[model samples]
Target chain A: MSQTVKKTFRCHPEPDECKGCGRCVSACPKKLLKLGSALNIMGVPYAEYSGEGCVGCGACFYTCPEPGAITIYEITPEA
Target chain B: MAEVVKFGRPKGFFETFERRPGSIKKNMSYCPGCGHGVLHKLIAEAMADFGIQDKTTFISPVGCSVFAYYYFDCFGLQVPHGRSAAAATGLTRANPDSIVIGYQGDGDLAAIGFNAFMQAANRGENYCVFFVNNAIYGMTGGQMAPTSLLGQKTATSPYGRNALTEGYPLKISEMVSQLESPVYVERVALTTPANIMKARKAVRKAIQINMEKKGFAFVEVLSGCPVNLKMKPADMDKFIDENMTKYFPLGVYKDVTAEREPVVRPVPTFEKADVEKALYRELPGGDQEHESCDSEIFNRELRIKIGGFGGQGVLSLGLIMAAMGKYRNLNVSWLPSYGPEMRGGTANCAVIVNKGPIGSPIVDSNCDLLVVLNRPSLDKYLPELGENGVLMYDSSTIKEVPAVKPGQKAIALNTGDIAEEFGNLKCANAVMLGAIGAMLTKHYLTPADAAKFQETAEAAIAECFAGKDKIVKMNIEACKLGFDKMQAAL
Candidate 1:
């Protein structure tokens, strides 16, 4: 077996770009995505990341219809 | 911490949508949860992955996807409503190596452009079609479409779709699979992640077939219209899975890609000599020597308006004058306006002649010369004459000669009585042409050119009535008689 390593994945939501239809909320397996109460410049509440526990399955990236709305990334800790 | 991009915007799309014409260039104009955006993302990703972005041509239909060109970085053509398939055929044939894609909705493909789509599929054009069926018109309000489910309540079908009236939903995939030309046909949905994966694969396959030039490929995407259907995104997905899939029955209806070879259409030739030979079998004649008119009066543009009742040959008179200008190597344009009736209707034509390039053919006002064969035409067009313009009227038909402006000259000719004396009342237009010839020689043309005006008029008549020797001879004689009488009057 290989050594255990800390895993980190994150979902970055562009507030101004998201139309906030809540599609990504349902698409997230870890339930780490939600719509914020505060509206963006488009007058609709945009989706936000929970700031933790993002497995980065990319479900929310595909589910979010708007281009450039949800971008997923992987983070590596400094050695 | 080090960041590694997992999933971001595809490189197939422009870094910023500069063509969208709005402040938000990062987002598309589709409504929230619109299926077009999802499909666009899938296609854009596939384009970037396949490296066909440079050769791919997306034909956008006239529905919500009309602005599709504003998003994709590939070559895009926004065709008229329901004409994407037709345009795709031409694009694919003209450039056989191009990867052509047609994006259409239910109304655009099934309702309006169904035949065009089917004919292209039948001919096996090398392209891919992504048909988005949302059961209702998304752009033009939630009107029921050909693919709308039975008992579905829409804006047009308020009482719900009735089987007896609205007809059943069209099974486009089933119908397209029945054709022999299409190499691949599948129906997929975008409700769940698994289903969306299937749709994504289907999209890639369709585009791959197109890239390989393996004949026509069609994928009918059963999508949702959340806003139009007045449902939330989750409820819309449930509605599509529970209600739509039962009717649509998602699966591959046909796949003959393994048996078919890559399609190869003949490339079109564009050689100048070949094109000329194909368009015209034989050249008419060597260029005729054209004499240039050098009169000082001909230096400026001459706008002439001719008006008369139908059967009075008003348009023919304008044609003769324009022909006179053409034979002398001058710029000329003729615009004819008339009612539907061939007789007893108001007919008028505007003829413009200039030594230089002419601007507009419309002579609504400020005409340099006004010719009227009837009283009503005289009354209607007299006010349009310019300050120093000339007015020519047939006095035989127009008994009351209206007073002219101070700088204007009115030459009233009894051409109607002259034609009657010439034994043919139908020759009155020819007599009027002769009167115009006399007027031009007196005022506009130089003496040297004036002597050739009669020859020009005769040649114009012969060219107008090329094969009719009898009519041409009669008109020429009548023109001579009218010219002598008008010269005497002048």
Candidate 2:
């Protein structure tokens, strides 16, 4: 079989105001985001992207209410 | 006649065009003419159309539409009534990359779960909360709900609900729109073709906004509960628009931004020692000592009940006790039944603390200790006390003595009178808590544990009283009195 194409989407959180309320994880159509082990400036859990099968639909970025808390980017084959 | 012709499948058919890989292929469990079915269908179609079905996480609530998991192809959670918002908050926060939809009914949204719902909106938690408003409580046999329209009658309201006595129906869409954090708030009805089209547009726009990761978005659909409304399916549109729409108006309430951001939260990996040092703290006792106490207490179970006047701290006491149980490393659960009983003039709560996981949060009958703050509570639940159970009550107001079953121990103390003497009438609950702690010493909880519980109780009470110090002090003393009395009785 041909090499399976895989894409990775990630969310970056702002350390100051992420309250750790997990709305983005539930809002993603790809089910790729989750609360990461890292703590923000306020010491709350922030969203983390771990799954490799991201469609880049921007659902997580759109559904996240915290500005600059969630950053979505796609990882292509070369990366 | 023109010749009939069929076109062949287009190129890249599997890759470019297909039904959403995540949507389930099954009929919904909603009733005929129920707006939930239509709304679910619309959402599924939208997800499929957008090719993001595999990424959605649907949060379902208790109501006529509780079985939403069976219909959605994505991961689904059937949450408790009014808790879908909180659950969605957890699920979405845990999986910010998934499409989360919090679905609930009017009773679930407006009455029981309003606080969580409002908090989520105020914080602008990213997700779409679709509230289905069908004037009456359809799943609970057409009871009058917070959103039940004035002048409408239901099981509880024999006559039409009077605005003067029952209060006007809550406009949830309007209420949610008033919050600053929410980016989009709209009310749409599924009554007629025109209204359906409007609702479809609103749904699409809300979903699109959610996809954009802008802010909190909500859509309230004024749906028809034909069976509960005593109307036929054919007349649902007329009934909803004429009666329901008049009470719950339809329109877009708020939309903050046009542009969207990419949603992503950063991940931090931590060492085991760092995690332990960060979460664990030194309390009154040393860390090792406390750890051993935790293990020992975690192996024991305790059930305590609190009953008193409506204004008394019955529910608060139960919560504090539950908190103490948690502090002791035991599994804890607290439940209260106070609406009609308290309104009819009484208050009560059941708290279960166990070493292992609890089977049910609700108690049908029998408890380890019955703490009665008033005569009615004593009379009502006194018989349900388990054999060898201890009964504690305030001696001040309870003048008439009712005969008890043999071998049941009843201790009467002037808790309310003592609380009044202590200068805080609300301390009656604290007194009961102290008595419970003293009586259940065999369960391995200490006076310090009880005091810690009291502190939590005081904090909650302060919030309720808007930070009143005198009330907190009085309740604290009442707790002391109960502890002292329980010692004397034991």
Candidate 3:
């Protein structure tokens, strides 16, 4: 059987659209996400991906109902 | 004993009294008579009393108590309203040594947080939940909450809540106590001195149990909201005595201490090999097969809608149908529309079964099959069905409705009457499920697959009627009757 490679992904939050609702924080299966002080172009507090021991369950990506607020993609070996 | 010689005061002598070394010390912004303040104080006092202040972690909700981190002298996380239980579950599961407290209000606990609360309780996570029942939405300015008593007026209920119109208040404490996983479940009040004493004892016992690393523990506190109720301090006691106590009586609903000795969870060791072995043991092949199958099915989609009254088992029926589709190796998804409108109003659920990966679970406009339980549900969703879709309804209640557009197939079944003839009113949902099963099984499942569906339905029936086999028999008959009716109609 081939081993399934485990990968890590970082979710970037658009501060302009974030209401600091903490929906992503609650939906994260790994609990590695937190609200950061850094403001985005819209001056709102965006979600900071801690990426500390993330399981990559994509629970946050699936449960987040906000459109264009949460952008998630894989962090390749080069990056 | 000899007198101890003291040098200059120790460097950390005042540190003990200053504040919890790791906890929060900020003053909270909760209003007076708001249960959140009292609950915060009780939780903080519990942590201090147990000497776990530094190790305690508090999970805050979104309502008036959203600023729970302000008062607690410990690590705190301000989470979304109604999701504190879920967050605390995650935190406690990851760091089992830390004392996790989930603090939530009536609106957050009973309204939008129902699924999270139920799933957590069902899992029996090692966390203490302090449910503060204020009956009205305080943060949102007196909106009707799930715990709002019948005939009670709120911002949304200008006229008193009518049972026939608005439905009854949800008894969450009693509901949670019914689950088998909870180690302790109790309801206490802070209205009077006697009640407050009981509440303190309950809170203390809950904290002590947490310190012992026990399983799930819950305490529902019947609290007051003077600002929301618009009641004077002097009238608060009378209001609670006359109004609140009638709906939320305080008592211990479940305590399993006498039944068995406490089971201690093994301290987790940090070993990559152990983690890998345990992960593989728990999830052997992973869920890749299930995911890939669902993706394949989603790649050819079909949308189906099922509607009925609140207690007619519409949601479960829809789930069973979706589960059957999954068992037959089809892609399936189910979503239930529930809330206040479900009590006296029509209830419905949407299921999307496909051959490939599906796009959305929510049914917005187009649907293939519309199963209506009542006239109102039919009237509400009839137009949303596509021109080629089939519409089915319970004929017992619905007599007349607006004309259906051409190209849509409409069929009515006397489901309630059929269930009554079978001597059970609850089996109408089973009948509808059987009907839907007969129609969809040919393409997605087999006769054996339908039997598997019936086996599950029967097991659920038997469990629901543990001591009453007659009821189970009647429900089975009802299922058969509905299946035969659909066969004849088709």
Candidate 4:
């Protein structure tokens, strides 16, 4: 419904620690993250996300549960 | 877009998970990101939200559920493995106004306690059953459970379970739904945030229904066991999402509260008179019969010694004395001593009855009365009898009458022959008790004490052989024989 809205934020996921649990994939309100084929250093799958439609509301990060799995960061526009 | 991160742990949990040196209390026994931790938070939050903490009586069964008592800041009853629902059933019935929560794990509920859970649900018992079905046994090493997947490999099922031999996983929520009693039934998972929210609703609803006095409400939680699943914490959640969900679809299976009415069980009575009616049938009062003149002769505590061969009703005689004292509202105690060999060894018991509270129950040396049915008992306890103490023996078993001390009273009767006339040798012990009862009357005691024990002796004999009318009649007749024989000697 808000396709015309400008992009708001970015996501910071610790790739090495991600166990590819895909909790954010199910918890993401904007449907930006997915459990992709990319494997981390531990040989476990990991979730991938894009900044195009990312609102960075932190639902994905909040529901991740596993510590150090992912982090949410704001993408501020230039002043 | 300046995103602000605002999130914190649930309020019911402790501030920090760190354990300092020599910390006495541990927060919880849950693994990181485990479904049990989330479920515990959800349940505690729901309990707090409903304002039922004061009324909650949590029943935590074996397995990991046993650790729930450490988390909930409320009254809890830790039950044996597979008996959570049964204990909850009793608690809810006894205190209909209280909220009872039965918390169980898969091995506890679905497997070992399947019958108990099924009975509680089928009866539509008023309680909330929160069954956590985490595929495999978590507390013990990974083992095949009632809800284990067909191809799941566990410690017990080293090779993956085969449908041909191991059978399919039990669908408990679905099975419970078929019953018409439960007002609510639902199966929810803890795989994702959305599912967890749904699970929260189900858990809250079940407790809410229980608070409303509704019938049984069950919530089956499809949890994850990452340790046994051979996966990381998050991956286990994904396993539940990908595999467990397909086997156990999440949804509400029943909601019949609209058509159903609340059940109200009658509260029980607490009056002492009611207790009397239930137990002894009548409050004990001084009987008019057997009134004696010298009931006040003896004013001190009555310490009695009754001894005989084993299996000769020595314990029964002492028990009758204690029961009579107890029934008459007197403090009483019966301490028995018997040799190792049950049938042939000497057996004896001491009976102490006081009008007031008793201090020490032992009468090691000084005894007010002694009744010995055999020579060995007489030889063992004769010299121990205090001055003025009465000694009654069955002469049929003793060949000679021993010399009695000057102040003490001694009476011997053919008790075995009297019992033989009554058609049973077992009545011989009853005869000795009768003589002791007769001596306690005006013959040897203060008039008040004699009167206090008068009507009680026959009544005690009657109550001792209760429901065995024939034996009671014979024992009473044998007792009267011993009484008349001892009375003539005096």
RMSD of each: 7.0, 18.3, 20.8, 7.2
Q: How big an interface RMSD has model 4?
A: 5.4
lDDT of 1 by residue, B171-288 (tens): 9999999999999999998878778889999999999999888999999999888999999999998999999999999999999999999988888768988875564333123125
The Cα error of candidate 2 at residue B161, in Å, is 1.2
Q: Candidate 3 - CAPRI tier? A: incorrect
How high is each candidate's TM-score? 0.70, 0.47, 0.46, 0.67
Q: How close is candidate 3 to the true structure, as a TM-score?
A: 0.46
Preferred candidate (TM-score higher): 1 or 4: 1
* Over 4 Å off, model 1: A1-79, B1-8, B14-33, B50-130, B139-143, B163-188, B192-220, B230-290, B466-470
C-alpha lDDT of all candidate models, in order: 0.89, 0.68, 0.69, 0.76
Give the Å error, residue A7, model 1.
16
Question: Regarding lDDT, does 1 or 4 come out ahead?
Answer: 1
**What C-alpha lDDT does candidate 3 achieve relative to the native structure?**
0.69
Q: What lDDT tens digits, residue by residue, belong to model 3 across residues B1-490?
A: 1222121111211223233243322223444344554455456556765778778888888887776565555788988868888898878777888888888888888888889998998888888889988788888899888888887889999897778877889898899999988889999876654566577789888877777767788999887777788874336546776788788787999988556355455667569989855633332222334433322223556788988778887887787667645554556688999768646656789999876556789985778788888877887898889877777778788887546778877766778887787677788887876676555454344455445656655655555456988876876677778878876776
Instruction: List model 4 lDDT by residue over B167-258, tens digit each.
Output: 99999999999999999999988777778778888988999899998899999998877777788656787788788879988898888977
Candidate 4 or 3, higher lDDT:
4
Q: Which ten residues in a row have the lowest lDDT in candidate 1 chain B?
A: B279-288
Regions more than 4 Å wrong, model 4: A1-22, A33-79, B1-29, B54-98, B110-126, B161-185, B192-198, B232-319, B332-352, B357-393, B398-412, B422-426, B442-444, B451-454, B464-474
Q: What DockQ was computed for model 3?
A: 0.01
**Candidate achieving the largest TM-score:** 1
Q: Model 3 RMSD to the real structure? A: 20.8
lDDT of 1 at B408: 96
